[model samples]
Target: MKSLTSLQHLSDQAILSILEQADGTEFPDFANRMAANVFLEPSTRTRCSFEMAEMNLGMRSLSIDEAGSSLQKGETLYDTVKTLEAIGVSAVIIRSKEKAFYNELQDVHIPIINAGDGSGDHPTQSLLDLLTIKQEFGSFRSLQIVISGDIRHSRIASANASVLKRLGAEVWFSGPQEWMPDGITPISADEGCRQADVWMSLRTQLERHDAMEPVFPNYLEQFGLTPERAERFKPHTILMHPGPVNRGVELHTSLVEAPFSRIFKQMANGVKVRQAVLAEVLKTKEEKRYEKAV
Candidate 1:
């Protein structure tokens, strides 16, 4: 069984296979199999989308959160996963506050899908984003994509930027200087707007920040996709955000549902992308079992 822990480990062929599966109409049957969602951190999109994907694939699923789980009693994450596996879970999806949380579960038998891990990576989100971009532009090569906003605090930024660059897209970072990560020189918001073929915004992670003060007092005017800035974008430029969006901060409220916005499309694609991932992992396990039986 293969666990999808990071996009870095997902090969080009595997990515193509997942995207192709997502585009197909037939659903694979895993009717008797069970999956578990262990979210140590709060989530809305990733969690619900995985649950929907599991349901659509005919898999029984259990949802566990920190408040209701044994972790509150000081049980470690590794133990929780092993317990789930012992209980006959076919796979486990985890979203934890710890970076690279999957490192501890190397011995677990079942597949572990990383929903999100601290500010480290969000592979599924990157997949859905790729699906969205591919559907729009037909390819990733030479695409000028700008990922703007809370860079340091965003798992999406690191995940998407790395994959996009590897796929031959010219990825640029844009946001407040303090939020930018090392080795990435961010362009001004206007420069990003003028050049980007795909402009992606990231929500300011207030929950991750220690200071309550705004990172930039005039964030919307200086770095956001305001109506005026939107006009500067090329006619074909499309907008994207890994939600939940800070309406007036990361992007102007008017731009959320604007004609070029692919924000909702990204959410819809999340289910399909996850369905493809789940199917691949489970089917691989089945294939190996069949081989052993033979």
Candidate 2:
């Protein structure tokens, strides 16, 4: 309850409760308390969604500038978190390139939400994805979701795989062999498209790789959700991406606007998912305070 670094920290009941709350119109008050968003990495969706979530939940938000803050002057993350605590924030949502970047802040009492950490996880994104899938299929049990494209360095793949499996979804991977991770089934993009109930594509993480030339010059033909491969999908098969989509690289540009594509819906649901998360964590903090008072 104090921190949300992984989905494993939550039970099925807990996850369901949050999702239900996300669907409601009622907003919880946090008196005048605030939350800090400290993003050391570039973000658009995650950052904006969380800020909107804060606004909808009746909580003020503080945006930390890593450049302007003492981090540029070599301040440790622990000290920065402690400073936010000193400023009386109720929670801290952080995104950094270092995996488990907040692990060292054992003494910091505020709730810490991990926005993302290297190729580690994007739990909130996965939760919204679950919400989107649940809306479409009613449940995750026995559903087939084929995730295609860059699997080796995608945090979305790592986060979604664990949660989807926990909810009884069969996850398959389709991409170049070099992009395949250990234990993932190496299905071809076309075959995966034909068999999937959902087709999720990923952006190539060029930033994560060291100096290298393009391994596959024709990535669209080799691994992308090209129009031909997309045509092979069943009528009910949905398309999804945790985007900043490389239009033709991961999926065809036209497919992004396809009727089955839930990419924009995913962005919309992100605010609700984050609102529920912030409310739940802040509510726990409130209860703890009341308990000590009694």
Candidate 3:
């Protein structure tokens, strides 16, 4: 595939390939190819992981600042990508507040990896999350995973649910009623915690709701991961978040350092997963080029 805008773009085989490569111990080189990251939105994990992935692959990199880029001077998305391509970048990683922002670059020639797009999808995050889970369970078949918190505005949840379910995992949602997605069976946070092999909490996107007032007055008591709730988690249950976590909102501060918390593991796995993606996409492109030349 030329670009990965959503988990739907990945087949089961492709997903397995990325997970397998991420599990490897050896680092691969990509000669001296170049890639650019254009993040029009604020980020910490996604941006840094992609940069680290390129560096690990022996590629030169460029990180575009929203304020300094030509976008500040009225450059369109297409123009920005074309400029990167003109400068010899064969791949571009982009994150934007606009949903499916990469859709506008269909004819841009260069490979576009969607770091994030509004509340759309974060495919790389999903892949690394899968890697983290697979490392824990050694398989996805029938594993119970409960994603709790602001599901209504979560791109991670959207990408993960699709990919995890596709891989034979049983995915469920738990959060504020208003924040739950349609069609998914919603369970109480406490019940979800009890049954889940993987309990993934999400930050409440207070910025997305009109009633920016906390979802509930004592949200910690009602929904957040309190000490009592933490103790109730299944013996081997894993906890996670796609962070910038609100300490006392979706999860308790202590759980951040809990033994079962795989938050940092997920971050570390992100680099490996992204490396796999960059290698696969760029390698495929180069092979096609060689075939045409012959």
Per-residue C-alpha lDDT of model 3 across residues 42-78, encoded as one tens digit per residue: 9999999999989999998988978988899888999
- For each of the candidates, the C-alpha root-mean-square deviation to the true structure, in angstroms, is 1.3, 1.3, 1.5
- Residue range 1-294, candidate 1, lDDT tens digits: 288999899788777678777877587788999999999888899999999999999999999999999999999999999999999999999999899999999899889999999999999999999999999998999999999999989999988988898888999999888888877789999999999999999999887888754567889998888999999999999999989988899899999999999999999999999998998899888888799899
Q: Per-residue lDDT tens digits of candidate 2, residues 1-294? A: 767888878998877777778877587676587999999999999999999989877789899868878999999999999999998999999999988786788899889999999998888998899999988988899999998877888899878988899889999998887777876667988789989999999999888866762477799888889888889989999999998988878888999989989999999999999988898788888889899899
Candidate achieving higher TM-score, 1 or 3: 1
TM-score, candidate 1, is 0.97
Better of 1 and 2 by lDDT: 1
Total backbone collisions for each predicted model:
0, 0, 0
What TM-score does each of the candidates earn? 0.97, 0.97, 0.96
Off by over 4 Å in 2: 212-214
Instruction: Show pairs that collide, candidate 2.
Output: none
Instruction: Find the 10 residues in a row with the least total lDDT in model 3.
Output: 206-215
